[model samples]
Target: MPRRSRTLTGLLLFTSLTLTTAGIAGIAATANASPEAPAAAAGAHTAHKAAYSMPGMPGMPASTRASGDDPDGDGYIMADPPVTGVTPSMEVPPPAYFHEFQAKCAPTHTAPDDPIVYPGQPGKSHDHTFMGNTTTNANTTTASLETGDTTCLAPGDKSGYWMPSLFDGDTKILPEGVQTIYYKSGVTDYRSVRPFPKGLRYVVGSPMQTQEEFKNLKGTVEGWECGDSFKNYNFPATCPDRQDVQLNLRLQAPSCWDGIHLDTPDHKSHMAYPVAGGANYNSCPADHPVALPMIEFKMAWPVNGDMSNVRLASGTGYSFHYDFMNGWDAATLDAMATHCIKGGLQCDPHGYDENHPGQGAVLDENYELP
Candidate 1:
């Protein structure tokens, strides 16, 4: 199996716009916003939803073999194996859904662990800051943006960005004497707007295009969203082309938050998995089990040759990064939290009960590059 690569930490500062009608100009105007605009002041606005995306990994079929020397040695041993004779599990999930979200200056959401390293440059390092505090303008414009220029942009923390673990706590834990973890495969297709969504940013100093390759091949495809019924919601008598090829190979566990417990109304609760169940090989360790979790996705539009920086166009170059955080449900979270407590790592849950910390464990820690 080929190893995944890490992403660049920082880029040279650049000026960009916020999304507002009149108070602030659109991203287009920001591309031309005069410095005389009195340097827009920061407002009291916080990130509402997590911005993240999975990046490309070696295709699942190819990734199945752990190494060459031991080519056939338990090569198919996975907690959840891939579906037989279907689209490769590594391809993007089918019917990828797109959501409109706010775009913010990158610096405001930096992770503490993010080290400042200028993009495409080496040896020189510096802190990054955002162009503004909130998207006060309604027209949605970004102005006078230039990469590698210090006068335009800013910095933010990049710590605790990716999902700590699929289990929600420290260490990879599996049941004793388990025969195999079961998983099903399905796909989801996703599309974007003309200029792509704005106000989208990542605290990890990472780019969004990196995750596209991953998103395209590993999107989750199950439950109501994937032609299944949770309510009286009548789905297609037969799956449509819109619902072609994309699929998620997940553990055949019951419905619960974050892919446990088979009962639930939401499909987004399902996270994309690389190695799922029901195979006759060994892709992962038998005694020690582990899986990746869903995280925030960050993406960026591409700037053309003559167009001003802020008016840049969106393309496959539009990178995406997933920030796997603590959003799993109580049961799975508590189990991992228990594991972490035993290991001496202090954790505190972000959105649940006071006693239960939504701590995540680390599994395959690396950037998802296409």
Candidate 2:
């Protein structure tokens, strides 16, 4: 497959907002592509609820694959293999009282393919470092995600997460630390928050635009930071050698959904952030009323003490953006939102709230709840 630069470690790369559909449904790949940096290839928006299928692999006849997540009887392996029993446990934590829970994820792989943007076309998209689901690629569909193993502490969270890669000249910088993912209520009435819809996916930052554009854009929680600094627009010119200091970025996705259309032509229209609803409550807009758990990505990288020669695969730090595809088991995810966010307690990836130890979520050593 024709491809871009890919490595185990990827770009701390961030920044970009331009996204456009490259091809039509069931689009076929070719050597020639548009002049624009393939970063513009957002997932194609289609009229059908079913995502567009990719070309089949060699020797893998539709009937030859093992039975898996394909509950729809498509004769394809769509889910992860069955999981074995795991031990139930909880983590010790300090007292806290916020309706938020967090999951930890590590980078799994880097690749040029994006199932959402350039599905089925292995080498067509920009390079990205992926986490959560380990087997993500150009052919990865929402169904495929269900059956894939995850790097996240939450095993049920087979969801796919990825962002542009970072590089020091030619050397790819792997994310040395875990990405702390938080699920919190975006509105004042935490009771109204719901779990993400099955197969729901969206892009969080605009890569096509410049760093300045991303800063003013809505839904951005932070740009880049080093230690105590919270407003570094791009990669810091130089990082300190302290334990607390490291290069990292933060992003927040919209918490309100239209309750329909898993995707749009732009891949972001179906979702919206909350607005003032009066009476001490923030509410989803009239058009998009469903309140889902707001997602915040706190990603950390290994690079520090660098004077220069750093850049993301997309562009500079400003081009930073990321993507997420829901793959959590419906019941498990719902229980988390209900028990934690709705319960108004701070929980971990395992749904274990320190203050509410009695309500600990049953999970395994890997931190995933069955």
Candidate 3:
């Protein structure tokens, strides 16, 4: 696709309003001097009723009741009552465990030719910032990826992940210390979670105008924030004076899979995000019972100034999306998922369990990225 320019005023305005409202609510709750607060009392009542609700995923029923009665007896009823389930355990892999990986920043002229976009047409897609497998391109296939050299710390890993390029005016900015961290937590039962099946491919985020939608609206884990503090997704952060405008783009892949299809026609129908707010928050759907390690991509770019001039080949900075092609050895990937992720142990790039030293796979200290 050809490069395009976009405006961010609407997104910024919506974000600002949301933050302001949240801040006001916090202040109001704090300023209320009455120990017998009505809001708190109401919340306690709702929480008690929510305990008995059935478990369900988004767009699915949590209970047999067509709808539940409004706790306050108001005419409008709330969303399906929250369901009950285990929450996924999450942690950040340490920097010491960073894999010895490297890839040159790909120019717009070198967009990959993969199933996610321009599947059979080379040069039909926009430029992307690629990593992991070095030979990813339009002609890459499952078989080709299996035999590809990987940039992962683990020699057995051949997965490839990439996102749109970040540009400041006419200059392309590259991410620094491009580290990939793995997490094993999900809302589903740990026993049901599994490693990514080989050859599975999918894309997260969108290249369309809807890309500007916030995480809650999109129902996906994606956002833009400052590199220094990547957690603040409420708004796009600004850099302090004299410092480069370093921004972080985060896209978290779906952890729930259907267990049957390695890929669907749309490349996404078989996968779903863990529910966000029910008793089953972050849990997988019944149809997609296999819980997999959640893969999150955080790309930090140096914009160097105001974002007004920032644009991506897809559209605007907010139009960010990413692709993932799983090429892991099935046995090794499964073991890592079962022993490290599901085991609730933080592992290094080589799959070494940091919690229990000497356990899990060890990296070749002498090995370097090709």
Candidate 4:
């Protein structure tokens, strides 16, 4: 993902956080799904999101953030702005926390279904490798997601995350090790980063896209990884034969969202990437003004060495796409944004920043529900 642009001087505030349980009681939850494909692991916040607004949006009933900035006049403000030159590294940089938090997960199952696109109809889509919400399928619903078993470290992360299944020759392969999914502040200001609404669903990338089109996507970080080197948009012809290191795919979701609709016919109309200002992204487009956590997926594939035949079920390596359905424990997710993001710190899968080990926002004892 492109770094926040300094071109749009001053600071921009993200508003519009009015999460309510209005749909089917069972399928009702936070409708927060970004266009980026984050390998989500943090327990998803439950469905009871308070009817409150973030910094730049109206109706800010209460705010834990101290009063400091009001770029768009939403009562909320930014006390301490983001550090100017701190570039995010693919790997977490020790104890220093950035404006980010993460969840780690492993594959739970595979199916030829997509609840968001072809709901209630299994086998309507291509085979997909799923993580989190173990029971995710074509019939998956918000209620089902909340109750399904999870592979993520955070118990609250009931959300379902998946990508087209990958294959080596004719045999299917799965990702090995823990997959880290990052939810970060997409806006330059982190104080107002709000949690996504429940049941929110969105698609990132498309199997039908051409290689050039995939390359033009703002959030595309297309590539494979083998130890120290990682620069191939398509799988490298080969990789070092090793166990410690596996092939990886890191993807990002668009951070900006439209406050109104949770989803649209296209599944992507409600979300958008930050617009370019100079060389970096400076602000969200007017249509998608709400700046939510930028979802980043660092998927770890099991294949190594022989990369002569590795491809996604969707098509060529460039035909990458993924899906997300918000099903987090509402309270937990909200706190994560409060302490880790608004507090401006990089956090672990449980939203804990060891460097500032004070009792701030963090995962509860079991990292899950009772």
Error of 3 at 69 (Å): 50
Query: Candidate 4, residue 108: CA error in Å?
Result: 0.7
Best by TM-score: 2
Cα misplacement distance, residue 119 of candidate 4 (Å): 1.0
| Model 3 global lDDT (CA atoms, 0 to 1) | 0.49
On residues 1-370, what C-alpha lDDT tens digit does candidate 1 reach at each position?
A: 2211112100100000000000112222112223421122111000111111212211111111222212232211111222123222222322312211111222221111111111112211111112223321111111211112211011111111221111101111111110111111111111100110111111221232233332333331221122232221112123223423211112121111111211001112122233333442111111111222122222211111222111101111122112211212224333322333222332221112223344343211221111
Q: Model 3: per-residue lDDT, tens digit, 1-370? A: 1111113322332332232112111111012123443333334323322322223311110112111121222111211221225334332323222221121222112242333443434444555656667667765666777887765556566677777655555454555533554555554345546667666776665554243253443334446665454444333435443455466665666766655445432345456666553554446655455677777665666554455666654555555667787877766676666656655566665556555775645344522221
The list of candidate 1 runs beyond 4 A from truth reads 1-215, 219-273, 279-289, 292-318, 322-370
lDDT of 2 at 230: 73
Structural RMSD, model 2 = 13.6
lDDT of 3 at 154: 60
The TM-score values for the models, in the order shown, are 0.23, 0.72, 0.63, 0.71
How close to the true structure is residue 4 of candidate 1, measured as C-alpha lDDT?
11
Higher lDDT: candidate 1 or 4?
A: 4
Q: Which wins on TM-score, candidate 1 or candidate 3?
A: 3
- CA shift at 275, candidate 2, in angstroms? 1.6
By TM-score, is 3 or 4 better? 4
Residue 205 accuracy (lDDT) in model 3: 50
RMSD of each: 21.4, 13.6, 18.8, 14.3
Off by over 4 Å in 4: 1-97, 277-281, 359-361, 368-370
Which candidate, 2 or 4, would have the higher lDDT against the true structure?
Answer: 2
Residues 170-267 of candidate 2 have per-residue lDDT tens digits of 56676764679999987777777778877777777655545666676566666788776677777778888677666888788888765544644345
Give residue 181's error in model 1 in angstroms: 26
